[model samples]
Every structure is written in structure tokens, then in C-alpha cells.
Target: MIRDYSQRLVVQEVAPRDGLQIEQKWVETDDKIALIDNLSACGFTRIEAGSFVSPKAIPALRDGDEVFHRIGRRPGVIYVALIPNVKGAERALAAHADELNLVMSASETHNRANMRMSCEQSLAGFGDIVRLVAGSGASLNATVATAFGCPFEGRIDEDRVASIVDTYREMGMQGITLADTTGMANPRQVARIVERVLGRIPAEALTLHFHNTRGLGLANVLAAYEAGARRFDASLGGLGGCPFAPGASGNICTEDLVAMCEELSIPTGIDLLKLIELSRTLPALVGHDVPGQVAKAGRNCDLHPVPAYVRTI
Candidate 1:
């Protein structure tokens, strides 16, 4: 059933921003730029390079300004930066980011802890941001963090998430990324939520962001894809997680996603082998082990024939 997608798959790399943000060690600016450069060569149309969050909150990505300024822009590759508020938006615009991603949590508890604002207040401020960036060449987007579930609040209601999405739509935003910040989603919930949200808004407007916390990240992606989700958020070497969500690993791996698409004859336009090669350099950069499976195991088509001598055993 997963192989039945008639639409082309869109994979958006979020390693530079979401992936690196949660790391304990610092990733150098040039290295981050090199990582972006590597992914750019892989035919990813949308790559989230960095974010504008404060240094105090996320010191690992403090060099966002430098990373943005240093990376050489590849033609046709959309380099997006996540912005938390107007200040972040201003910084992103100054850095010449191709797109600006704003975010707020669906649950009040998580929103207060992560963003320190109520849901209603954040939505009200989103309108102000929309007006502020009206003439900017950069595209404006808002990610609904913890749309699937929140660590602080436990299970999140679908209707509440739908309300937030409706608010985002009212802002005339072209894109909205629904994030599983705590990796609490399963296949059934993913399909149900994506189906309902996409019904209210266009499928093109919704992007699913899943964390591999419970080992259901890929399954959730499959569920959303079957429910008509086209774009997904992935990281090279599976490099990211919520600082708030304990034991949560990085995002869905880019190489694994590409391999799935390739095996299914879907047009992802990304080369998995090259992306896996790029993932090898990530461990030293982040000073930790990554969680991507395809980085360690070869694709299904990459299997070798069993030797006759081994078969005899």
C-alpha cells in the first residue's frame, strides 16, 4: 500500500537547522556550509540551512548568522532559515534566506515552555509577522511544533491542531510544516491528522516533520504519504531532536527516504548513495553517534548474491 503514491515525493532536508540545533557540541560554520553544499548537490529543492533562535536557547546554532552569510547559494535550491519571532525574521531576511520558517506549539503547556507564549497570543503575533514580511522576497512559513503530540501535555487533540492550522491559513501562508517534536505519532494518527488537515488546506501546503523517537518515524511518513502528503522533513545521518523531548533521536534520515522513493520508482530527484557518503562526516562534526539506518546498511538493491559455499552451510 505504501508504494501506491501517484504523486512525486518532496524531501526537505532539515539537518542544518533542526538536526544541529539539538547537538551538544558545536558544528563549525564552514562545516555546516560544507554540509549544505553537499546536500545541495543531491537535488534537494528545499533545504533548511539554519535558524534565527537566540544563542542562549540554542548555543549550538549560534553561528546561524555566519552560516547564512558564508554558504554559497546554489541556483534553484531553496535555502530556508527558521525564525522564532520578529527579531529572528529580521536576521533571516538580512542573511538573504530564501524562506523564513516561524513556529509555535499547539498545546499551551509546550508553547509556554518552548516559546513562552499562549496559543492565542502567538497566532495574533503571526499576523503581525505576515504583515512585516509582506514585501520581502523570502517566503514566509509557520511550523506547528508538537502537532502530533507534546511531551509536556501528553496527547494532543486533532481539532486543536486543526484550529492552529486554520490560523496559519488565515495568515495567507503558503507553507506549514507539522512537526512531531516528541516523536509521539503512530501510523493511524498520522494518516488521520494529515487527511483532516489536508482536507482543510491544500496538500501542497502541508509538510510532515517526524522524529524517530519511537522508531515509527518512517512508518508515520508512509502513513502521511498515503494520505496525500508530498513534502517531508528529514536530516542527513538522522541528526536532530527536541531538547525538551528526552531520548528522542534526530529526524527521518534523508538517505533512507531516498532509497524508499527510488525502490518505489517515485521521483525524489535525490541520489541516496551520495547522501549516505555525506552522512559519514557528521559524527565527528557533532561529536556523537547518529541514528540513521541506511547510513549503516546498504539499500535492498545493494544486496549481493549469496555464495554457493555459504548456501551449502
Candidate 2:
């Protein structure tokens, strides 16, 4: 089968929430708002602005409400808030989040470790959240963490992932994300599962989230894209990981993904230069250098003048 590679891709920025959640240093609420404001102008249609979980659970995003309220909302940008349960969903709704993202692990062990609940219990809680957010003018996005593989369980079944997507669809969630929580997904596996999931859900309604723990993040992304997935989630400077998931590391970098898309002539509708500049600010925010590579390696078009000795030679 001939694969079409000319589709425009949606890059959803998850820096504010996912990127900073595990940072030990505190990023001021004002700085978070500033970052969002800057990103709002960079042509992203969706940005995961913050999470509404308890401060004790995720102290880095404790000021989520303030950040959401103060940031300038671009007209076309959908500001999203990650919610853990019904209470977080309520807070996200009250804070005027454009979209509420609910998460659960595909693996039972991972779910218990991450959410302290069984997969069934988490889905039951989501039932109440779906009812509460119904007709509230806010869209819901369901994320299946450890969808590709689990650190504790090693390999996950594709049938289990499909069943979870079915449950989310039955609950009236049109937006769904398959998260490579521990970065254990490879290109072939990603393509297979993505193709399988696309059989049950529309490609437009699905998003792929990948981590670079095993150095296959971008490869997995390419595989999914070939399998008809167009939307993806990436963090600035490759900053992200689950506190509860062992071996989980940084997400695929935003600028790196944009660079790859640019090289392949895939339209991402994002300003690569602006995204790079934004990524450069992460080192100071976290009090150390970030894991992203684009900031250090200039674009392919960047050229340096030849040295006098080299010219003579």
C-alpha cells in the first residue's frame, strides 16, 4: 500500500503541565503564564496548559488555576488542563479550561501505581467526570497511559488498548491519546497498534504521545504517522516524565519533532524558530540544561564561516 505523507500534523504543546510537573525547582506562576503566552503566538491549535491535580500530588503545577486565568488565550488555541479525577475535572472546568484531559494507564499495575486505583475504578470515576463535564462547553480528552508498553508488565496487549478506547468512546470522549508512558514502544509495534486503534477510532480524534527513554520516540512517531495518526503531544526541551513510572524519561522534544516534520515537508503550522527560542529558556527555568538537542545543534541551514587555516589548506 502506498502511504500518503502530505497530511498536515497537529502538534499539541505539553510543556507547562507535563514538562514542569517533575521538576524539583519551582517555576513561578507568572513565568508559566509568560511561557503559555509566548507559545500562544507560535501557531499551536492546542496547548496542555496545566493540570488540576492536588498541590501535594504535583506541587510544580500547584498554581494551575492562576496560570490559566492569567495567560492570554489566543483565539484559535484550545488551552487544556490535565485532570486526575472528578475533583480535578471540576477545578479545571471552574478555571475555564478549553479542554479537560483525563488519564488512566492501560496496564493494571501501572494504573495502581500511577493513580492508586484499579483500571476499572478509574473508568468508573471517569463516568462521573464525563457526566459532570457534559454540556459544560469544555471538551474532554481521554489519555491511555502505558498504552504501548508498561515498565512493570513489560509488554501490553493490543486488545487491551482497543478495549480501553472502546470504553472512552462509549463515554462520549471524542479525543483520545495513546501514551508511550515508559518510552518502550518501537516503530513496528507503534505502527501495528496505531493501525489497530485507527480501526476503532477516527484518525483525527486520536493523538500519539511518545517518550525518548529508549531512543525510539521519533521513530515510533513516524511509524504512527504512516499508520494514519496526525496529532501528537510533545514537551519543550524534552522535559517530561511520570513520577510514578520507573524508567520513564523525557518526552519527544517539540523543536526536534518540528524539525523532523520540516525536513519531511510535513506541515505542522508551528514556527520552528520561535519554538526553538522557547526551548532555550528551559535551562534557566529548571536550573540546569535540558535534554533537547535542537537548542544545541543549530538548524540544517545554519552555516559557519570557514577558518583562515581551513581556507588556506
- Best candidate, TM-score: 2
Q: Tens digit of lDDT per residue, candidate 2, span 98-134?
A: 9999999999999999899999899999999999999
Off by over 4 Å in 1: 1-3, 244-248, 305-308, 311-313
List TM-scores for all candidates, in order. Answer: 0.94, 0.97
Candidate 1 per-residue lDDT over residues 5-97, each given as its tens digit: 667889999999888887888777889899889889988999999999899988988989889898878899999999888888889889999
| Residue 267 error, candidate 2, Å | 0.4
Clashing residue pairs, candidate 1? 240-250
The clash numbers for all candidates, in the given order, read: 1, 0
Clashing pairs in 2: none
Segments in model 2 whose C-alpha atoms lie over 4 Å from true places: 1-3, 242-249
